[model samples]
Structures are given as structure tokens and as C-alpha cells.
Target: MTGRTADPGLIGLLGFVIATLTAQLEHLGVQNESPVFWIGAVFGGVVQVTAGMLAYFQGDDFHFLVYNAFGWYWICMPGFLLGGELGFFEVAGPARGVFSLMFAILALGFAFPASMHNSVLPVTLLCVSGGLGLQAAGAFTGVELLGTVGAVLLLAASALAAYLLAEKFVWRTMRRRVVPLGRPWIAGDPDRES
Candidate 1:
């Protein structure tokens, strides 16, 4: 017990922001090809998983679950893509829709609890959930418009997550609440002392 607090949320959020933004760019056709595999594997998968483990050791259950879940999502996404590319299996459009839907549901499920934490958290989760839902719908219907919407939403979510990361890690570390995260939605929250 070093009595030291580990700020794994920062790293995890950073990983999420980068990977998500990269993917969104590809979806928007701003990038011709996705280099998401390596980025997701390293930053999203490895870094986030490490953050999850550290969060667990630090006794932050919320962060532990969030980080780990997203970490696995990042890790497995590449595997699925690679498998399809390698002809090991086919990744049909409907299958991709199902995959996106699953994560969208997961994000929504997590958003409720996150709402109790802080204003920024729930907002970020909601944006991400909405984006994922749009992506699922697009894949299912083979609609380009829905995918475009999803890409925009993902970009918004990434921006919000980046703000949260800066607030939590940078400003807080400097003992300056430079960015206001707003009040927690849950009234009379014990975690926050006003």
C-alpha cells in the first residue's frame, strides 16, 4: 500500500478519444484507409486495459469496469476485422450492425450510473451511445447518411471526452479547476463535497 492515488481514468479516456476520433475520420472519408488497427491495439487496448487494472487496484469500480469493457472492445475489434480480411470468417453488414448495437446498449447502460458521477460523464456516454446507435442503424440499412451522422456524433463524443480528461488530469493536478465539469446529476452526492 503506497497510499498513492493512481489516475487511470486519464489514460483510459485519452486512449478512447484518440481511437474514436481516428475511426470517425475514416468513416467520414477524411482518411482513405483506417490505421485504426494499430492505434486501437496499442492505445485503446493495451493502455486502457492497463488503466482498468490500475483502477481496480485503486478501488475505483466504475472506472475498472468502463476501462476494461472498452479495452476489450478495442482489442477484439481488430481481431474481427483481421479475421474477415484473412478469410477466416465473413463480417457481414448485419453482423456489424449487431456488433454496434451491442456496444450502443452497453454504453447506455453505463450512462445511467455515470450520470451520478458528474455532468460531463453522462454527456460523453450519451453522445457515444447515440453515435454507436447511428452506426448500427446505418450498417443494418446500408445507409450512408446514418453513418455520416454517426461519424459526427463520434467526433462530438471524442471532444467531450478530451475535455473531461483535461479537467480531471491536467487542471485538477494543477490544483486549478480551470474547466467546470458542472454539478453531479444525483442530488446530495456524497462523493462530491461542495
Candidate 2:
């Protein structure tokens, strides 16, 4: 049997949306903190990292990096916070801002390359960057409004990621594009049909 593996993007995006939405909800006070960290560590961290490895095996360099990097982000954030609160070490408020800003930069780094692929991913990355930026701002200023808006942005990113997952996997069995994922922002033929 010489068949290929299923698309890792499906699981990756599934995990992405799950973690993003859950975290956003928790941030917005719609959920409790207890489940959020565990979800982030398991689905967002471990699962995404595993998916990224699968993507690498499939020769998808971009998705591979996206999944693993964000996966580690999910893992480390909770780990650091928990470690700090558990007396393992101290966590400074300023360090949170710097940490978030760093990831925001990293998310922005993928914007252009993602733009070359499809409209959704670049926009998704932009929302992720915006969310992280706002989160950083909130962390620095201690203003809840910034974080609230950031969580909203993350929710939007989650929705977009879900749509992308459907376009890639769910309706993929169809001959035509059942769930459209708009044109690439920077493709060779923007007007050309796929």
C-alpha cells in the first residue's frame, strides 16, 4: 500500500481553533481558568506539535513551522505562568509583554509567505499578530480593554482557521471548491481561476 497520509492541516487547524477560541473565551470571562491551561497544553501544544511533525513528513515546510512554533508557544506560556505561581520562579509583568511581542513578531513574519498561499491564512496570521500585540499592550498597561479586544481578535482568527480547515479537509472530497478560501493575496495570477 503506497497511499499518503491524511492532511495534517486538518488536525493542526482544529487544534488551533480549539485553543484560540478557548483561550479567548477564558480571557473574556466566559470560561474558567482551570480548563484553559490544560487545553492549551494538550491540544494546542502537544497535538499541534505532533501535527507539525506529520506536516514535515508530508514536505509542507510552512505548516510544519507554524504548528510547531505555535504549539511551543502554547506550551511555554502556561508552563511559565504555572511555574511562577507554583514558586519555581518569578514572572515579571514586563516580561509577559516582551514575550507576547516576540511571538507577535514571529506571527507577522509568516504574513507575507502565507499571503502567497491564500487569503485566509494571511488574514488569520494578521489577526493572531494583532491579538498578541494587544495582549502585550494589556500586559504592559494592566488595562483589561486591550486584552478584551485582543481576545476578540483571537476568536476571529479561530473562526477563519475553522473555515480554512473546512476548505482543506471536510469538503475536499468534492470535485469543486465547496468551501471557498478566497484568492491568494500575492499569487502569480490573482485573477486566474484555480
Question: What lDDT would each prediction earn against the true structure?
Answer: 0.83, 0.84
For model 2 the TM-score comes to: 0.91
**Candidate 1 lDDT, tens digit per residue, 43-152?**
87898899999989977788888899889888877776677778887676888889888888989888887877778888888888999999999999999899899889
Tens digits of per-residue lDDT for model 2 on 59-142? 778889999999999898678658776878666587888988998898999887888777888899999999999999999999
lDDT of model number 1: 0.83
Q: What TM-score, over all chains together, does every model reach?
A: 0.92, 0.91
What global local distance difference test value does model 2 have? 0.84
- Overlapping backbone residue pairs in candidate 2 total 0
**Model 1: colliding residue pairs:** none
Find the 10 residues in a row with the least total lDDT in model 2. Answer: 185-194
Highest-lDDT candidate: 2
